[model samples]
Target: MLPLFPITLAAAALFAPAVAGAAEPQARALQPLMAAEVAAGAPGVTAYVDDGHRVWQGAAGVADVRTGRRLRPTDRFRAGSNTKSMVSTVVLQLVGEHRLALTDTVARRLGPVLPYANRVTVRNLLNHTSGIPDNATPPAVELFKGDPFRRWRPEELVALVADLPQEFPAGSAWNYSNTNYTLLGMMVERSTGHTLAQEVERRILRPLGLRDSSMPLHEPTPSGSFARGYSLDYDDEYNQIPETLRDVTAHDSSGYFAAGNLVTTEADLARFFRALLSGRLLSPALLAEMKTTVPTSYGPGIRYGLGLFFFDDTPCGTLIGHGGGMPGYENQFASTPDGRHQVGIMRNYEEAPDAVTEAQGTLWSKAMELACAA
Candidate 1:
């Protein structure tokens, strides 16, 4: 199933054959698959597709369930953990500049942010091998449910789990934790004396000509045109509350800061993925480092590289991107290893039922099948 992977990205290009500008017929087939997600209980869905040559976009369902306005390809989203890939890009860029080294420990950059900082290297954090414990557990979710609008700072997020025990010794095993990225975000500011947003803007957004993308760090909802987000409200006990489907479009997400708060459109995300995997965003040697992966606990046969994920055994082969989700939105994007075919899907609702999740998975597979078609 993982026919091409656990191999170098250079060899991967040989398998996928430089994907860009999908065929028109294959591209047009996505609109209906998007509609099927709405029929399965999603408030809305939007997507983007690109082969090296042409770009296509489609959407179905309503942006606002109450107002019944149609979702559009141009709508913005809180691109969740996808922010990790961008932040990882900057960290690697710093590595290429000789300003930062993967071997550098967190304590070297920010003195003892965690009890075990000295032992945790920058590379460990990037690949989720830092042994940092995640604080965003069910109980923490309960805390936020009490005051969904309560404002939080990055310091508070770090402090929330500082005393917790490590998952394992650094580099001994793999566990995904938002705390790793949050610290790296802090290190970026400490190293460059610029906000994470500024670095992302100058180094990534501006350079790639991605005008529709912006990192609104502390803001709850994205500015300009964005789908009003909604979620199936549940208690900390995982019980569906009364009137479960509620609008969480403005919940304060400062806690998600570097880990999940970047906002952009489907089209912008598609371009970012294309440019990144095509080696435009990172130097060849550094890009190879970004793609060097290890197995993860998240799923079977799947692997995680520094900031990206290798989704093994998919219809389109291994997809190299990330997925971000919070209370009210879900964003997933990926591409062929060669950057020849890129796809992104953004929807307004989050935490759907199993039936719906399965349907969404089907939607993704079908879309990739079309995307990888000859």
Candidate 2:
């Protein structure tokens, strides 16, 4: 049961206030919940919920710690690994057009430049069944940690892990590897003879009218009024070395590249996932293929599909969307199986206090409540 507050829906809409001028009661529960997250140690949080008819959004805490600027729901933030879904959508569209096949080996598609490319399949890359180890090794992190504005070439990024031992034999196990999608991005570029950003804009963003989203090729910061991302700069031993957070909003997302370089707002993310799940983005057959699940090594009740995740054991029954993390942001967007109800949440700080994670978990529970109600 939702926490009964004896307030009417309209009054509830005023609980945290809405950003888009009008507020929905369905979104009321999130405002204070987000506030609690901020109080618990998150620098800021912005969230939106679409309950079929209208979209309601809320923000909590500061966008910048230096000036103490309030975070707004309208502000854009890095979507992080959520970019994978957009990339996968473009790849699937090509597959639908008969330009590529999921079974096509990476070596066959890209001419076997990398040693492990021939052994990995396109489908393996999409579902993370490929044993490509993540490229964010300690050396890479040490090299880039203080130099956030450095531009990284895609080949250089892929070369970091191409020669490393596989995490497991291809298709034998599951481990989340950003390198898999980075390779997929290369494949998309090779297959289409266009940049991955160009293909995504032409195929997904423009078609969906996601005006607030973009693939940041070299920009280190989001355009417009964007939240300033922060990191606690914890060490490998989980010890807080600096005892203070650093502003990381200007870090070059080009390092993440096709794996997680997307800059988007909560509303735009909600819209994209809604369209993807509604059969408006991919064919019914491909959409089904996209939803086919393999156990994500992350946790139980969570399964990785081609590019999306299915959470069936949640209070909202089955919902599909992906959660993303970068150096300074942790975000999630989930929608009902049929795309009727959707929610997105963003926290502007990573490596935050444990209480922040607990507060965010509470927000997830609230999201389930809102989705189930919808």
Q: Pick the candidate with the highest TM-score.
A: 2
Candidate-wise lDDT, in order: 0.76, 0.79
- Model 1 TM-score on a 0 to 1 scale: 0.88
TM-score of each: 0.88, 0.90
**Given candidate 2, what's the lDDT at residue 217?**
75
Candidate 2, residues 1-374: lDDT per residue as tens digits? Answer: 10111111111122243355534565556767876787666778887777666677788777766666778888888888899999999999999988899999988987655677778899999999999888765323642344656678778877888678888889999999888888889888988999999999999999999999999777867788888877666465656544456566776677788888899898889889989999999999999999999998878998999999888877677889998887678999999888988878898877566777799989978866776675
Task: Candidate 1: give the clashing pairs.
Answer: 19-340, 20-51, 20-52, 20-340, 21-51, 21-52, 21-53, 21-54
TM-score of 2: 0.90
lDDT tens digits by residue: candidate 1, 1-374 = 00111111111111111112335664456655665666666767776666545666777776766555667778887788999999999999999988899999988988877898899999999999999997565323732366655676767778888898888999999999999988888888888999888999999999988888888855656788788776666666767553245677776676676787688887778778888988999999999999999889877868999999999887777889999987678888999898888877777777655545676777777667766764
lDDT of 2: 0.79
